[model samples]
Target: MTDHPLRYDINLSILFTELPLLERPAAAAAAGFTAVEFWWPFDAAVPDGSDVDRFAAAVEDAGVQLVGLNFYAGDMPGGDRGLVSWPARSAEFRANIGVALALGARLGCRAFNALYGNRVDDATPEQQDELAAENLALAAKAAAEQGAVVLLEPVSGAPRYPLRTAADVVAVMDGVERDAGADNLRLLFDLYHLTVNGDDIPAAIDAYASRTGHVQIADAPGRHEPGTGNIDIDGHLAALADAGYSGWVGLEYKPSGSSTDSLDWLPRARRSSS
Candidate 1:
């Protein structure tokens, strides 16, 4: 990749799992990255304020910008995609937004990823969709207090999860915006997930580039770094650039080998946009 056009941020959660959470930020900085993102940093939805302070310190001490963060989505290691639509855990999800935003605000981050959880035995599809809309709307409004936006994405590999296509997420965003009268909701253009769901990447970017608030990537067959799979990662990035998406492109893929070694495809000079 000759002078990659996009401003790329390392996903601290996935890329540096070998290190402790607090250490990942510095590792990313050592790798020449100026920015990073993560899933919820704590197991608890609302971590203690001291813990929140520590989380903020780690990022600040590392000298890297925290560009994105996910609201708690339940036990991620246990296969829970999210709790945004789970009726049982709705309260937990809502309570975490303020803490997430405050922590994010400390790091100058405004884009938040809200995963749509797997289908729960307690709620029907209709009921789940309804709750999702309400929670998303609520989240959007909360993020708005600080001029942030809530990002919704469709993921693959979870058979029970509902939002598996770009269109599905877009529809939910549409409903949330129209019904709840919120405008801070936007699509998370994660090309790897869309490709796994068999969506046309070019068409998706063409249709929703301007509506996209964030972008993430990995390759299919195996969710590894680019060039290890068949997905045209660079070409898709080019297309995104052509479509005028001049935002952070998150490196959210599992490393093909050691995390540091996996970043070979991306030049160090291009790692830090500044």
Candidate 2:
């Protein structure tokens, strides 16, 4: 296996679905990961306090760092990606800010991903974009208060979702930074989605790595673990390192079989921190 210079973290939400949510951090630890990230682990816009406490405890007990998290994206299993751009759901998104920041502070997490909402039938693209910028600015301000950065990602295969290119997300990031006067907003550069969208992977790393807050990976054509499909994971990772990005590369791929069985591509040296 090639030596990857970047630090790595598993996305508990995607890779360890076979385990209970509270049990995933330990599973990741047992698998040799010292850091982990995940999508919002709640089904509702606001989860119960006890659930939050339990999650915090689970990570603490597992001795893994909570390196990144997503702000409340509603009903992920039901196909809702995020709420930041929905004008009607603006309050819901705002309500999640304090909770998210508190959790981030407790976990020493510095990266938060805020997915841009899909275009709504009742709202014009202009309206949606305007609403998204407003919410992102608010999120950026809140994240800054906690010394954390808010991230924007361009997802593929979701046509209704407006930001589908690195350029698209960077434009939104610029708007938010200008509006908020805060530099806490950055890109969540996921190579799998970009590859699926037919983006120039190497070019993207060169163009946006400096401004990227986090990076995620899965192989194209199947969104499975690396080496199971056609993405140059090593090349992009090398490019990111060359570009001076030292953030975590999140393992956000689905396993072809058991999740543990699919980790052969990750060299043991890259699995845990020194």
Candidate 3:
């Protein structure tokens, strides 16, 4: 088996809602984790509880790395409703990307996740793809300046968004690389969504692994943990290895029981070398 790094998103967004951000890393370490992640840290500010400096200190104290940061949600005040697809919201999207990069820097994270939010009815598929490519190219140029890369995730079942296939992501990346002249732009392949969108997970991974900088997982039907649902997660991991993937596989799933209770499967997942 090829060597691969195993970094999970302690997903503090759901795991420790009761605990403060500065305290989540310690909690994750106590659970036998050496890395932690969250969805967004927009609210983190200076001289306060949610400050990223405090979070950085916490991670250093615990000797854990901040593996990933997903900045997908755009519901904040004055924020854009959707990124990439909306022409009117391009400025807002750029500003958000800047914030995400700064936060990643503070938390010692090198990766930031961008979303292809809902598509627009007025825009054709070609138009949406073009817009997404341009936005990602711009973001990539800025992020590369900061020593970070933007990982785009495609979500289906949502109307108006552009990315749905591995091809779409590839096209976007190609456009970004060509326009921005930077090869740091990449994709974040979520196995659960690939299953939902009817992609052959292993085949898709093999095809796009070189461009995939990060991954997320959950089971089908309910999007729960690996063993509790129907996804062939072990096989997926093996495929990831075969495809030459060497990044973190984030546990971005929801828990059926309490987060701690569902963590029983963590050891098995961590132990599996696939």
Candidate 4:
């Protein structure tokens, strides 16, 4: 067994993109990961029921646990990171919660990430923040019913998108809890984003571990697999373990070559633990 205490899960959305979405889980399983996570699988917030069934079947067939998932961010690759804060898109976000919850229930996923929407030309920052707080509060309640927690991630590389620091996300989480009267909302401590935004990683872990609901990692400067970039993956992970974060560390990196080629950082022994 590896010395590290954090369990690892592959992020099928960023890695394994060479294959079809439904085919990626089995591909991850074949590559030795026993748990996986993904962004919303459908282009639209509320996809057809048949689409959901097929996706569900794929995960069940792959035999991997779905440990984490994102609430529908508008167009991930096309520059729309999320819509939870957008006034015009709030309906689309609300429509996605039931679908996300059902899939989470099916996969026994307890972590649901809610990306804060970018600032819109038509809406003031206060308007978006208010909308986001209200929508996320609703999401927290829905996720709570499923015994899950809602996550807020501070993204880098998107300037208009607010919440780029650990403090920013936790503040939002606290506001969400206060507004909803539910404690199911927490921060998603993504190391890659934290590093990109220039936050001290170990300091972030020390400050936010208890309030963090989920964690994702990719090395800095390239968003590639661990050890390929400058981050001290081992040291930071040890810090997380020391801080009592016995949760899944999502491998949310882009593979330099084939997705399987990125397994060098993950030990063979630890890859198959569900």
TM-scores, each model vs. reference: 0.98, 0.98, 0.83, 0.97
lDDT of 2 by residue, 191-248 (tens): 9988888778788888999999999999878999988887888888888988999899
Tens-digit lDDT string for candidate 3 (1-274)? 2134554556666565567777777877777777677766544212244455666677779766776876645653444325666665666676677666776787678887777666667767677667877877777787788788888876655644557777777777887787768699788888887788888777787789889988888878788777877888767876787778878877777788876677787674562223
Error of 3 at 173 (Å): 1.1
Question: What is the descending lDDT order?
Answer: 1, 4, 2, 3
Q: What is the lDDT of residue 107 in candidate 4?
A: 86
Considering summed lDDT, which 10 consecutive residues are worst modelled in model 3? 41-50
Off by over 4 Å in 4: 1-3
Which ranges of candidate 1 are over 4 A from the true structure?
2-4
lDDT digits (tens) for residues 50-90 of candidate 4: 99999999999999999999999998888998989998899
Query: lDDT per model, in order?
Result: 0.90, 0.89, 0.71, 0.89
For TM-score, candidate 1 versus 3, the one ahead is 1
Global Cα lDDT for candidate 2 = 0.89
Instruction: Report lDDT (Cα) of residue 196, candidate 3.
Output: 82
What candidate 3 gets wrong by more than 4 Å, as runs, is 1-7, 18-22, 43-63, 76-82, 121-127, 268-274
